[model samples]
Target: MLLAGEQWAARFEEFQREAWRLETLPQYLMPQESEELQEFRDGTRIDPATVHNEYTDRLRRQATQGRLQGRVHIVTRPLAEYLRFEFAWYYAPHSLAGERIRILDVTDRPNPLDGVQDFWMFDHSEVVLMNYEPDGRQINREVFEGDPAKFIEYQRIAISESVSFEEYVTGFDL
Candidate 1:
């Protein structure tokens, strides 16, 4: 079924062992981040030391507790402005906060998981499909409980083919 608002928020708190996300978009339109995004577009940069949210706090807690929380974002060269902001402001802090971030730069190589959309695989048991529009507006999350084997495999493939956030960023200009 479709999950949005509180339902989407609940998944993070509910997942026991791991909350793995496969991010296929270069940017995301987050309502709560409208102002920040706009400022980013206007040329203000986010200080990693000051960038934070409840979500990153949760990531810290999970990491301290020996739980896994991470994601793989597929990106191309000449990064999107939002992505520049996200990596500089959002992803950097999240990584420092103990969330594992990987990048799949498919600017040259063929995407191994071309057809896969964004998704969250919880504890390798359930999956939540993250639906988004062309401009990166989130439509809603869809929960899939039947069998998550495919998603689990996708995670494996992503991790194997991707590089750590630090390595990836250092190789780029952002």
Candidate 2:
């Protein structure tokens, strides 16, 4: 059953709070940027509105495709280097609400190196990343399991194709 109108509002509020609480730590978080975002920043100047449109388009596409099933929770973290400028954006699943229960974000660690207890819900089959890299590329991490090293490799590929910071924040799906 699809949550509509007022019911969705309540559910969304609950999800937001739950998402924030779950994502409050640093270790569970993943890096946002890849070399591609750097290339975009180095190559051109982009406005926040443009970035917003990019994300909106992406999400609209996803919505149309029905990929955004359930109460999908999204958390976007800004990436900065040299503590000077915000370079990239990180997107992760904070929760998934549906009968299948495909994904869930249970922790808020900022960097993945902090050693997190990976929650293998539903037999470790539902971990999917829509935007795995700072470049705005989407991916599902479940396919790359077994080899820990391949996880990072998959991330690298996703980041290489991710969208810009502007797109990530404003244009793309949050």
- Judged by lDDT, which candidate is best? 1
Cα error of candidate 1 at position 134, Å: 2.1
Write candidate 1's Cα lDDT for 123-169 as tens digits. 99989998899789988888986889889899999999999999988
Clashes of 1: 0
Where is model 1 more than 4 Å wrong at Cα? 171-173
What is the C-alpha local distance difference test score of each model? Answer: 0.88, 0.30
- Per-residue lDDT of 36 in model 2: 37
Off by over 4 Å in 2: 1-36, 40-43, 51-56, 64-79, 82-114, 117-125, 128-140, 143-174
**TM match of model 1 to true structure:** 0.93
* Candidate 2 residue-wise lDDT, 1-174, digit = tens: 323357433432333211111111222222454453465457543442334444345444444444442221122343223111222222321111111111122235343222322211111222222223333232333322343443344333333434323344454323
